[model samples]
Target: MESILATMGDQLGQMLVVLGGALAVGFAGSGSAWGIGLANEAAAGIMTEDPKKFGYALVLLALPGTQGIYGLLVAVLAMQKAGLLGGGSVALTVWQGFGICCACLPIAIAGFYSAIWQGKSSAATILMIAKRPEQIGKAVILPAMCETYAVFGLLVSILMLNGIKL
Candidate 1:
């Protein structure tokens, strides 16, 4: 009976760790899709007006996609940390699994929100550059401001994941 209960507990912990990886990928991927869509809509409009601005609009449109990549990085790191990536296993208590899940949340939440707001900022910058194409340099900076938070989130997630010993 004791061995059976311990097995069940270990299974639950493994499941929770998998869930964390899924959440990181799912939420961040969805946000990237939405954010990219938002920016593309604006880019399409600007391009329609002035086809020549495609080069400028493309740069701004790509900014929001970074959050998804950051999320993926965290997911991969977490999986590697948990020994799930290399077809190995780690004995994690439920508390340890929960801690890993919580660690992933910073990047998951930040990536989602930051990508969205960055898209909005990118859209605005797209419109701005439509008129003053010469201001492309300055325009890129606006959307980049929103990216800062995503970077911070990624950093925190990495640090947290590293702190959790298997």
Candidate 2:
């Protein structure tokens, strides 16, 4: 039984690493898409009332997209660390695979939820913009503040991926 468990871990290591990368990309992108969709919906309502605000409203709608991009970046970095890129494969121990997966979690979790909340903030900013067009500068800042954590997550994931030795 012990031998079987060891073999299972060995066999599953590479797959787990790949799965981690996939999860990072998938969750973050999905969250961004949902958040952007929500913000866009609100923007559409505002657009109907005042078409002149399209450009301003779009700025807020686009804010959540950064998290998805960050996710993709982290996925790429994770894949590279896993040696799944550049047509070169490296054999990873089960523990290494587990490390990679663990490293991905910070960005995956942070990016997913941060984007949703950022979208909410953006939507609220959009509302503020609708009410006070002159306050557009202040409106953009509100959503941007939520982005700080996603950036930190991306940084940590990068550092963790870089630190892992195949």
Candidate 3:
């Protein structure tokens, strides 16, 4: 009975680690998709009005995609830390697994919201570019500003993961 309980506990811990990775990827990717979709719709509308501005529209639409990539990185790192990627799987205590999950939380939550807000900013930038094609540089800067918070989230996630004891 003791062995069985220990085994079950370990399994739950492993599941929590896996859940962290899934949440990191799923939430962040979903946000990026939402943001990109919004920007793309706006881009398409702009293109219909002025096909010549496709290049500008494309640039703006792509800005929010970085968050998805950041989320993916966090997920991969979490998996590696959880021993899901390397050949030797590590046996993690429940506390360790919970720590891993908490580490992933920053990126998962922040990336989701940042991507969405960035997309909105990018979509607005697209409209601005449509009006003043010459201000392309300035327009890009606005959306890029929204990317800062996503970077912060990525940094925090990395730091938290690094601080976690195996």
Q: Number of clashes in every candidate structure?
A: 0, 0, 0
> Each model's C-alpha lDDT?
0.88, 0.88, 0.89
Per-residue alpha-carbon lDDT of candidate 1 for residues 69-152, written as tens digits (9 for 90 to 100)? 988998888878788887778888898888888888888999999999999999999999988999999999999999999999
State how far residue 38 of model 3 sits from its true place (Å). Answer: 1.1
Give one digit per residue, the lDDT tens place, for model 2 in 89-146: 7788878888898888778888999899999999988988898999999999998998
| Candidate closest to the true structure, highest TM-score | 3
For candidate 2, give the lDDT of residue 85.
88
For candidate 3, lDDT tens digit of each residue in 61-132?
888998889989998998898888865888888898998888888888988998999899999989998899
Record all residue pairs in model 2 with backbone atoms less than 3 Å apart, i.e. clashing: none
Q: Report the candidate with higher lDDT, 2 versus 3.
A: 3
Candidate 2 overall Cα lDDT vs. reference?
0.88
TM-scores for the candidates: 0.93, 0.91, 0.94
Regions more than 4 Å wrong, model 2: 1-11
What TM-score does candidate 3 reach?
0.94
